[model samples]
Target: MKLSQLGEFGLIKNARDIFKSLNENIVVGIGDDCAAIKLRKGFLLIATTDALVEGIHFKLDYIQPYQLGIKSININLSDIAAMGGIPLHALLSIAVPPNISVNFMDDFFKGVKDGAKRFKVSIIGGNVSSSKNEFSINMAILGEVKKKYMLLRKGAKAGDKIFVTGYLGDSAAGLEILKRSQKSEVRSQKKRKLIKRHLMPIPRLEEGRFLAVKKLATSMTDISDGLASDIRRICEESDVGANIFTKNIPISKELKDFTSSQLKTRGTHPADGSSKLITSLNFALYGGEDYELLFTAKPENVKKLKELWKNVNIPITMIGEITKKGINLVNIDGKAIPLTKEGYNHFKG
Candidate 1:
């Protein structure tokens, strides 16, 4: 059953039936000229949009339609999470070639439904168009947050402590493994966990909200573009600088093992451990799409923040501190090396 046979109306009807929503905030959902949503009083409305295109963001060989659906929604939700907002509704837009199978769309929507359901988000409406060759998906997510609890990229001040939630570079390392297509590596459970992280990044909504509601975070943003690049955003927005301690940056055990294996495969000995460590550290610093929360907190509140963070399951690490000037990475021996933005750039070429 190809999409060409179903035509546009049939495709939309299928979507309407599949994405039925009971969210009370939605005054009008799918099958309307415009989906109407009622904004809650005393809360600020937050909206964000993102796109995933074939060949650019992902390849069909490496990702399934279902996983693609989940990734698309999760990425957008991350923006909402960064602002300490609760997601309410979504508008999904997709363009596919006419030859695309109906089953493909069904599985994709199933993934979207499951992902949205996890955060209590409703799919209100979207537009479908026929593309010539490639597949593209774009999602606009709507959320709400109390004015007092809303967090932004600004407000980080000098001497504020920097923190990140969870491990970094797992997604980029997973992407590396997928591209290598090593049969043995793919079979390992540890490697599969990396692949899962790359495919379906978990948004740190609870962590973001906790930081916002407790007034713990002075500034915050999700690490979609890697620490090296995103930390610059905070510095630029807040007009401050940062000094990241290399030893404090959290690296997962699996990532260390993966880098070690790569060196061994290249005929390098474990005796030259510095080479392996640097490789893994580079990934933690420059690899994009980690989706973890990168935030700053005033030094005076660090004690209280740490005490309250015990209630959260995910671990938070203090990686660095806000400085007066210059973005630098401080080595173990206290050498400060200037850092650069090496994360994802749409027009780098």
Candidate 2:
């Protein structure tokens, strides 16, 4: 049935039934005017909000309502993770055309409920409204962290080592493949993995929490906007420079395979493979939505951090170091090139 048939209250009733909460802290939940919660004592609350709009953030042809639901929640959870906080409650708001089906909304809400449950968060409240032609989703997440364990973007210092969890560029590469593939189904395992990276990025919550609890990270943020753009945020906030080694940046094997295949298909000579390298590197450097943790730590604690990082499944890699001045990438041939912010910018035309 279409949403217009359900009416606003009926649509809201559907949401309330799906997201009903059982936590003692949630004194007021979905049916109430405002969801009220008891904050944990001795912890500071951290809140973050994010939005996704059709055409701009995603296309109906490229993503399902279920994946969209989870993606919406995961992106917000990433912000909480960046500060080493535990996500507790969420407020979801969505606007869709009246013609949208109630079944579509059901699957989407199911996705949201599953995603939030995985992190022990309650979907306490939200708003739903009709849109003219587009579909939009917005979420506000509330989390808490001890004051001593909270990390931020401004604590990095000169000579601190920069590190990231998991592989980069896969998401960007996956997105490119999706655009090129269009409606045709992608069958290759490598391609599928890349596409999944783009569609369902895993937030580095465990790694972020470990670094914060152990007092290891000097500064941290999630890689939502690509390294080239996000590293500038750390630099601006911390008042430091950075030197990233081209050789040290982590690239997934799938990405390397894809780039190699592209060059071979184009009959490019091995000696002229600079274009191939640049293509892959560009994805890693400027392709956003990786959702991995990018953090800095004191040089002295590098050994300890590495030794303790064995507990997490995601591998941590050091790619660069904070510097006294200038943000540059040290190329394979030892040339220092100034880095630019070329990642996704909502306002960029």
Candidate 3:
């Protein structure tokens, strides 16, 4: 059945059935004027909202409705994670065209339910509306962190060490492969891995929480907008500068293979590995939506942080250092290049 047949009220009922709150703190969930939840005393609430629109943030050709649903929640959850908070509840609002299928909606909601379950978040309330042409999802997530454990982007100081969790550029490379595959046949294990990274980015919630509770991070931000852009944000907010060492930036072997394959397909010299490496580095620096944490800590905390992080198993690489005032990227040979805001820009034409 089409959404047009079920109508808005029926859709609401379906959503309510699928997303019944499991948390005791949620006094009221769906079917109410407003969702209500009890917050623990001495904790500060953190709220973040993110929207994904068809043809803008995503394309239905490559992304399934289920993946879209999960992506919507994860993106907002990432924001809360960046603030070092534990996501507790969410409000999901979606707009769909009349012709959208009931099964598609079901799959989408199933994804949402699965994501909420994995993250221990409750889908407490939401709204669904008709769209003229495109499908869109707007998710508002609410989380909490103890006042002393709250992390912000404005706390880095000069001489701090900058670190990023996990490898970068796989998502962007995945997206590139997806776009490329539409016109050409691209098949490989690396391609699949990269695509998975783009489709299902893992929010570093545990890492963020550990950093916050341990007071390990002086400043933190999630890499939704790529390292170059996000690092610039931290610098701007903290009134400091950064020097990122190109050699220290982490890129997975899978991503390197994908980039090499792409370059070879473009008729680049097979033996010119340097160009391929440079291309991969570009993706690592500017590719957005990795959803990894980019954080800084005082130089002195480096040893303790690494010691604590050993058990977590997430790869944390010290890619840079907080400088006194300007953003610069130092190459392998110590050539300092001026860095700019080159990440995703919603308004950039």
Model 3 TM-score, 2 decimals: 0.95
**lDDT, each prediction:** 0.88, 0.88, 0.88
C-alpha displacement of 14 in model 3, angstroms?
Answer: 0.7
lDDT by residue (158-247, candidate 1, tens digit) is 999999999998887787778768544435887888888899999999899999999999999999878998999999999999999999
Q: What residue pairs are clashing in model 2? A: none
lDDT of 3 by residue, 162-190 (tens): 99999998888887777657735667787
TM-score, candidate 2, is 0.95
What TM-score would each prediction reach against the true structure?
A: 0.95, 0.95, 0.95
Which residue pairs in candidate 1 collide? none
**What's the C-alpha lDDT at position 27 in model 1?**
92
Task: Per model, state how many residue pairs clash.
Answer: 0, 0, 0
RMSD of each: 3.7, 3.6, 3.6
